[model samples]
Target chain A: MQKLGDFKLPQFFNYPPYFTLQPVRETREKQVQLWKELILEYCRTQKIFVIGLEEEFPLFSNPEIERSLSHEAREAFVSALVSDGRAEWLDKGHRKCLILWHRIQDWAEIIINFVKENGLEDSVMTVEEIRSGIESRGTELHGLDRIILMRALKLLEHKGKLAIFKGTTADDEGVKFSI
Target chain B: MKEQLATFRSQLEEFARKHRNDIRKNPAFRSQFHEMCAKVGVDPLASNKGLWAELLGIGDFYYELGVQIVEICLATRPHNGGLINLQELCNLLRQKRKHDREAVSEDDCLRAISKLKVMGSGFEVITAGKKKLVRSVPTELKKDHNEILELAQAQGFVAVDEVERRLSWTLGRAIDALDTLLDEGLAMIDDGHEDGKRRYWFPCVSSISSVGADS
Candidate 1:
């Protein structure tokens, strides 16, 4: 097993074929599936919300074997993720991708549970505060991406479980939980 | 003589009909049959509308094989150009003909490709030492190129110095042949040797196991 910054990588990460894009159809399909799983697992554990295609992403290359995914292979794996709704291309050029380790609906449910457990069901908190708040400490919600948090909050608000309103400053946003 | 020839023809027809299965299944038996046909002044694969063609359909058989060979060569041309090893070509042909009853041999492939020569595409088998390679393109391989390829067969590859020493050719002659082979994609250049000698590898003549290890 290879580890990247405390994130344990799978044994297949060392397999050379995992780095090169396979030309055979069946083999390529299996390779893509494995890459998708590894990418999602790595993102979820490392709290990585976005991946830049051209940037130095740790999971994309292995220095031990001196093998790295080509641009086409990166696009292929990310495209597979996009098709499955596990990831989305944030830029028109597909250079940037937003990985959704947890679906928006699942994130909303997690937020509701967090608020209930913290006794903030009827209380208000700034969007930034919920991300790094003491109440959310030691939880997956802590240090989460603001974009994902807002989407989850908006989902909750649609169900009449919360209300999102901007603070005095245009950049500052706050959420009121009716749960 | 005419009456004897007619009797011999009838006898051959009977022999062919009796051993038709053996001719198709066994390459040695098929070659023996071809020899017997030649001995009796009969050309089994001469034409599609002849008595031999009507009896054994050998002409049609080779014709079908020629079409398949063309297909395989065209399909693999992008990867290996028009030059392919006879064994590799036969393996691919076998894979394509998995459901067919006929077992193809190198002799069969040679015969089929020989038939393809009439189309003016320069289909022929060139011997590199003990190995046989099928060249589908019209590129005429001169004496120097043949010598180098044959010399490279001992090992999977050859250096220019080795070619010069073995063939007693000047450095320029060896380089010209090698450069032509390189440009034609028949040989691959390797510059990673410690002795600073450039190695030219012939993928067609090299054994599969050794190739895997080298790569």
Candidate 2:
């Protein structure tokens, strides 16, 4: 029943060892698998793109249990996600993690679906507008990371589904969809 | 007398060969057949090289079920710490084999588990209080540990005082058993409760499994 701002946490979140990394190989592997799943799910729903190792992220600590994950445990978990291609460490010291709940390939699919649904195909949209414009206000593309969005756009452009045009500023960069 | 026994065995084997499909398809029929075999002291599933085995092919069936049992045990070992309730194991086996025509009874599961003894000392069916538990790990659980686990079955957890008061044991005996289970990774500690007493939770015998397994 525990919730982090309407994000329901799993029952095992209250388990003390969930904070302390397990030493047993089998137990630790399951624990890590569960943590990876919960992290990705929470991020996907909350639209969280980044996690700071040193910061007081809500999921990293449980006030009800008075237990918090140690720095080592945090690094170990996000490092696990990084190796799985679900996340990436932004710095050398592993201080920050960029969570890719949806892989880039999946993002491309979402983009195409969004264009088709919005009847925006064969039309033009600026790069920044797609990120925060009224059309994308309630969609996943809204508030999306610029790097991931651009990568998806570049991927689509390479496939001849769209064309990218230069603009006076990065925000004004335009994309014309041929699909 | 020996000649008469031989005749009976051959006749029973012939009957089993005829009803092999019924034995494989019906859980109730299979249990009754196994019970009947037990009464006559006829080893219908003991060996795979005999005319009886070839006639029924039930030996391979049991072996296949044994492998599935091992896989289920290993997959759930982390959650239950290598121990699982017998009925629960059977339920999971049935779920895993849902596509098959046969409904797997607990008796069938027990027979399959017996066939798995050759794997090692790791597979065992031990009685914890009144409940039967299948222990997949080679970890030796003493009588006190079994009693502790039995106590934990009620609430999925036990505190030192609860163990001492319920089992009428001194504090030393309870702590020793709890500590052993904790060392085995069979139990987890919870010290965050409002009462401040450390509650030892046994996941193996506990009825409640974790949620959020949804994709």
Candidate 3:
């Protein structure tokens, strides 16, 4: 019943054993699955894309229970996510991770839907416009990470569904949708 | 009338004089003879003729209880020839000394042997084992060893070494103590089945009713 920023946490999130990496295989597998779901759910709802091991992550620690996942447990859960292709290590040290609540393909589909719904099938827009434009308001695309949005745009571009071009300004990038 | 009383007194005095010498030789016989003389109002010093007969009869039952106690102690340790050994008896004496240290004495084996014989119920004295032979009461020793052996048997198939370890004694001492009981025919040693190990047990002791589980 615990809520963080409109996301309802599962009952097991408060379980102390959830913080400790279980030694038994079956129990650990279940623990890792639960962690994967929670991490994806929290990141998707809160628009949280990056998780730094050194930095405080709300899901990793429970101040009420005075229990925090150790560094090993954090790596294990994140590694499980990476193995499942839902998250990736941002650095070789794995100190930071980029959670992909929506995989690049899924993101591309969302972009296609957004463009079609807005009646802008042939129109061009900057990468930033797709993230925070009025048309994208109240949608999952709003305030999304630029890097993730760019990655999703590049995937669509590679598939010939859209074309990406550099804008005149240093910060802006343009995207052209074909369909 | 005075002459008749005088004649009767002389006859009783003659009987006392005849047995007096034999009675004096055996204190028990002398006491019985003295009592009989007193009943007939005879003078013991005056009668010396039937003294040996009177002494033998009294001596027969004098230590009858003592003999029975020795018999029970012998039954307890049957290995010993109706005599309880010093070392095994010392162990019992040691136990007794704990509660009453004053009970300790070199003469305890002899006294305990005599005490059991006097009690006269299911006991005997026996000399136990070829070496360190001494007097012991088997029935009492059975009761004593039963308390300790029951505890050892509770472990189920206790190793010979384990018994030695728990008693805080070396293998030799444990075997020596056990051998005393064996000489009494209360315990047996089984060997040669496998690995050449000897297991000691009391077939009659019945401390543990279940056997196959340990085997």
Query: What is the Cα-based lDDT of residue A135 in candidate 1?
Result: 89
Q: Compared with the true structure, what per-residue lDDT tens digits does model 1 show for residues A13-59? A: 75444565654454456568779989999998888999999999998
Q: Model 2 over residues B82-104: C-alpha lDDT tens digits? A: 88888878877877788987788
Which portions of model 1 miss their true places by more than 4 Å? A1-179, B194-196, B207-215
Chain A alone, TM-score per model: 0.94, 0.92, 0.94
Query: What is the two-chain DockQ of model 2?
Result: 0.27
lDDT of 3 by residue, B5-112 (tens): 668656655754676555434545555655665565654333224453353332232233235334334333322223333454444444433653233333334434
Q: Which 10 consecutive positions of candidate 1 chain A have the poorest summed lDDT?
A: A22-31
lDDT of each: 0.80, 0.83, 0.61
- On lDDT, the candidate that comes out on top is 2
* Pairs that clash in candidate 1: none
Question: What is the Å distance of residue A116 in model 3 from its true position?
Answer: 1.0
lDDT of 3 by residue, A1-179 (tens): 57886888876565444566754454456568778988998988788999998899999887765667889989999999999989989899999998999887898899999999999999999998999989999999999888889989999899998899988987798998998
RMSD of each: 10.9, 5.7, 31.4
Write model 2 residue lDDT over A1-179, tens digit each, in one string.
Answer: 88888898887787665676765566677778889988999999989898999998888988887877889888888999999999888889899888999987788888998899999999999999889888888888999998789888999999998999989975689999998
Q: What TM-score would you give candidate 2 relative to the actual structure?
A: 0.71
Give, for candidate 2 chain B, the lowest lDDT window spanning 10 residues.
B206-215
lDDT of 1 at A177: 90
